[model samples]
Every structure is written in C-alpha cells, then in structure tokens.
Target: MRWRSTLVAAAVGAAALLAPVLVAPTASAHGWVTNPPSRQDHCSTGAVSFDCGGLQYEPQSVEAPKGSMQCSGGGGFTVLDDESLPWPRTQIDNSVTMRWQLKAQHATSTWEYFVDGVLHRTFDDHGAKPDAVVEHTVDNLPAGDHTILARWNVADTVNAFYACVDVTVGEGGGTTEPPVDPTDPPVEPGDCDVAAWDPAAVYVLGDRATVGGHTYEARWWTRGENPTTTGEWGAWRDLGAC
Candidate 1:
C-alpha cells in the first residue's frame, strides 16, 4: 500500500509538538522506558489506538489467508512497527537503554519487535492486557526524528498489539536530556469558501486559514485567470489567512 507523504508529514509534525506532555514520555538519559511507536509511521497499515497517554495510529488487521497475521476482533489498536533503528527519537550516547511496553489485544498472539522494520525480538503475549513492557538497550542512535513501529504477528479480536517505549539517553550525563519542544497539535485543515466532502481526496487551492476548531488552506482550483464560478475550493469562509 502507498502512504500519503503529505499526511505522514503532518503526523510527524504533530508528534514533534507533543513533547511537553509532562509525563516525560517514559524516556531517560541512560535508563529504559516503553511505549507504543508513533502513529505516523503506521498510518499506511494501522488504525488509531490508545498509547502512552494519548493516542497513536496503529497497524491495520493483517489480511487473512493472504497473510499469516490477522486481527481477531476488528483488530486491536495500533502496535509498534518501526522502520528505523532507535526510531521515534535519537541523539543518544553509549550508556542509554530503551524499553517499549507492548500491549496486545489477544493474550494468545505472539508479539514481534522491529528496528528499521526488521525483526529484532519476539514475545508470546499470554494475557490480553493494555500495557506490556518490552525492554531494549541503545548503544548509539542517530540524532533526529526517528520512525519507530510495532505490530502483532497474529491479529486477534481478543488481542491487541502495542509498544510503549522508554528511552534513556545518557548514563551519567547530568544534562544530556533530549531537547524538548512544547507545542499543540494543529487543528484539522479546513476548506476555503466552501466545505468540500472527502478531504482525503482533494483539498482546495489557496493559502491556509485557521479559525475556531478548523484550519483551512486557501486553495485555488483555477489558474491565473478567474473562472466563471468565482470562489475558493479548499479555502474557508470563516477563517481568514492561515
């Protein structure tokens, strides 16, 4: 399946802004913490699921017959399925360790861990719990934003697959905490002059405008010349310049 680069970028931007959640994100300079991977990386295959404190996009139910993995109930929330090593976040030194708490909807399903989308570890989840801790150590992780993802090998309605990661950056470094940025997630993008249906397909052409509970990008459907029907497509009439 193809992933929408635009939406993915938006999600990453959202995650980046979620740094000041106050819970410390189960992270440490050199210690280990656990949580599910971000939702952006799994949007192509996962759905929305509860993680850490808020919510994250999780993997969709694995296709049955066509694939070995399958979700029993409608498929549990998103699970960790990262495609990069030390994903989710980076910039760590030697002495740091990271642990992820994986939760599965089905207790009998086997949960798997991936680094850069590669299988690194596996566990047999026996209990259908919301928070299950999986530990891993980080020798060195590239500094910058990382895409960490996790999912279940077998999907069952009764089971859920999740990963809550805990990252410890430095062992003894007193001031080696990862840089923190506190911001709020952007409200949903809005339309220009009209309210268009199925924004997933097309957005009006115009500059962005935000107001009330919506954010609209003023987009023009026509080029330089004005068309007989003079109005904006994706532009919002309520919100001004965005």
Candidate 2:
C-alpha cells in the first residue's frame, strides 16, 4: 500500500483561526466533530472547544460575532481553509476515499463544491430544510494538490455553516492487490487473477463472487474503481449506456 502520511496541523486552529488558542494534544481525533453537544457557545479566547470523531475539539475557535459564528446559542463552526488539511488536490489517487458532513441554517439555498478554486460539484437544497447532511465521494482522483471549496448561499439566509471531513487514502489503482508479490508461491499464467481485474467494471451490490472461503459482494463505488464494498453508499447510478 502506498501510504500517504498526512501532515496534520501542529495545532488544529493554526490554519483557520486568526489567533492561537492552547489545548491538550496527546489524544487522537476520535472520528466525528460534534457541534454544541448541549447547544452552548464554548468559544472563549485562550479557551478551546470543538468536535471531531467522538471527542470535542480542543483549542477550538473563539466565537466572534463578525465572522462565520453567528448565533451564540445555536451553533458555530469553521471552514477548512488550510491547504495542509489533506484537501486531496491534483495527483491524488482516485482509489483514496474522502467524505465530509455539512450543516447550515435556513438561509443557504445552493451549496457548491470547488476544487482548486474551480467549481466541481453543486447541491441545491431548494429550501427543503436546514441542517441537512450532504456527503460526496469521488474516485480515481488525479494526483496533485487540489482544493475543495464548499460555498453556500450564506447571503440569503440567517444560518451558520458547519462541516467535518473524513478522508481515506487507498493504494490501489486498477488492481486489488499488489501486482507482484515475492513471498507467495509462483502460479502459472492464466491462473484466476481475481485481484488483477477492476471490480468497478463487473461486480455490483447484490452481485456475488464466492471463492476461497470469501464471499465478495458488489457494493457501490466508494472511491478509485467501481464495484467496491464500502458501507457508505453513494447516489445511485444509471447502468444504461450513454
């Protein structure tokens, strides 16, 4: 596996907030950042509170009435503007998976996602409701430094924007396993090379392949190639030919 080591911010708020706040740094981020667990504003200068995974963010951003944090009792969050937060820019392997949850107030109408300052994907809530969670996954993303920008119609509503990201970087391209392995017994050509084939091209959820005590099912594409087994399902795709 091609391990891409992430350069995490020495401090969480180093890249986004205007000033620095000190907090504990020994624990690993649990998974998801929760917002206002009790609907209270804990952002005070020099004090820290935010959410990630299961633990609240340490050294959280201080609440500012002029910036993104709007209501004191409602909720407040910071946009990920740092380039080092693993934004998955160009040259990134498509096999890598990334996800983030979005929360906004009533004013947001359209949410547009941008990569490297260019518009990539847009979602229209149509004023359906507030605090909607919109998730996206892209596959086989080209390698390079890319920036994903999520811009909402904040000018039209009285809502505050909040987001938390989860990124999984994988090592496969078209092949499932390492193309060459020196430790295994040599098998002759024409041997069933199951890992050599792209799963996205064939297996699909409800579709099954039984071999060697393992039953593989075709789940939706999470990232990289098709026919993956990620539990995080994606928007349904039309199998018909274009």
- Candidate that scores best on lDDT: 1
27-127 per-residue lDDT for model 2 (tens digits): 32111122211111122121223332211343222122223312221233332322233222123454433332332234435554444444444444444
lDDT of 2: 0.32
Candidate 1 local lDDT, 17-116, one digit each (tens) = 8856754654211101233333332232233333311222222222122122321112233233322323334335532333443333233344454444
Clashes of each: 68, 28
How well does candidate 1 match the true structure in TM-score terms?
0.26
Give the lDDT of residue 198 in candidate 2: 36
Cα deviation at 208, candidate 1, in Å, is 62
